[model samples]
Target: MPKKLIQRFSPKPETLKAHPHLKYFGEILQNPNLWHLNRRSAAGAVAIGLFCAWMPIPFQMLLASLLAMFFCVNLPLSVALVWISNPITMPPLFYGAYRLGASILNEPIREFHFELSFHWLAHAIETIAPALLLGSFILGVISAASGYFMLRILWRINIANKWQRRNKK
Candidate 1:
């Protein structure tokens, strides 16, 4: 079942609550619903996580966790999803967003040369910020909606199959 599967992969609530960074959220993290593995929480966490993953911000996991807390979703899963945009995958995913945004806004796609210097970073941000932000927002929304609905459908199907097996016995 999705609940069991998610629970198996999720961090324990006590561990999260004990974490120094997450402790800043205080008593809000104590809400039981935020840790539940129900369909609504799981799907909502997926949506929140996917949306935050597409964000260009520095603290996507923190953002995901905050959203999960606000929405009363499965906090661990939401936070975990932000790893989808970790260092290994970030370049391609962000570049794709930049390309899409440029296409949507009728901006010319520019080739990026990576430089370790702050000056190059600043210049590139000035040129690409608008397209990158727009594209990221679009992708985030699409992924979130897709994840929410897909999880709901898959969870329902899993339940139905289990019921069928039980009835056969």
Candidate 2:
């Protein structure tokens, strides 16, 4: 008969120290009463970040950071989250925005014929410029505000649950 080897169940210490940025790594962390405050700020930041990401405007990350600071949100995290929109997603998002804006304005959707030249690009811009700007701003504000409210509710519930758990212990 062959002998079977048993694996140890101990967790590695390095794996446990996951988030280095957090103040308390493995210690008994004290619960703070300012839970609602932090939660609201974080929620607002995430919401604004997502909106900024989806907006077709240039330099969106910078705009998001400035907005986050002005709105008193978690600036670093909000700005970081704005990367949700990248080059890969830009084309589809811009197309959708254009469609929406054209529909709303009772204008027929213009079809683009892509050519391998800078002249074609300039023509495309001239055609869609108005719709792009209008749609991007509208969608950005709508998405951002929606995200803010949804996150706010979620954070409130989570914080309340944590507060209750700490009190129970």
Top TM-score: which candidate number? 1
Q: Candidate 2, residues 11-121: lDDT per residue as tens digits?
A: 222442354643352342122211113656667777878888877778898788667656766555576668877888888887888888887777789988669899996
Candidate 2: segments with Cα more than 4 A from true spot: 1-37, 114-118, 167-169
TM-score, prediction 1: 0.94
Question: lDDT at 120 for candidate 2?
Answer: 91
Clashing residue pairs found in predicted model 1 = none
Separately for all candidates shown, the number of backbone clashes (residues 3 or more apart, or on different chains) is 0, 0
Top-lDDT candidate index: 1
lDDT of 1 by residue, 1-169 (tens): 4577778878889998999987888999899999988889999999999999999999898899889989999898999999999999999999999999999999999988889999998998899999999999999999999999999999899999999999999
lDDT for 158 (candidate 1) = 91
The estimated TM-scores of all candidates read 0.94, 0.68
lDDT agreement of model 1 with the native: 0.93
Instruction: Report the poorest 10 consecutive residues by lDDT, candidate 1.
Output: 1-10
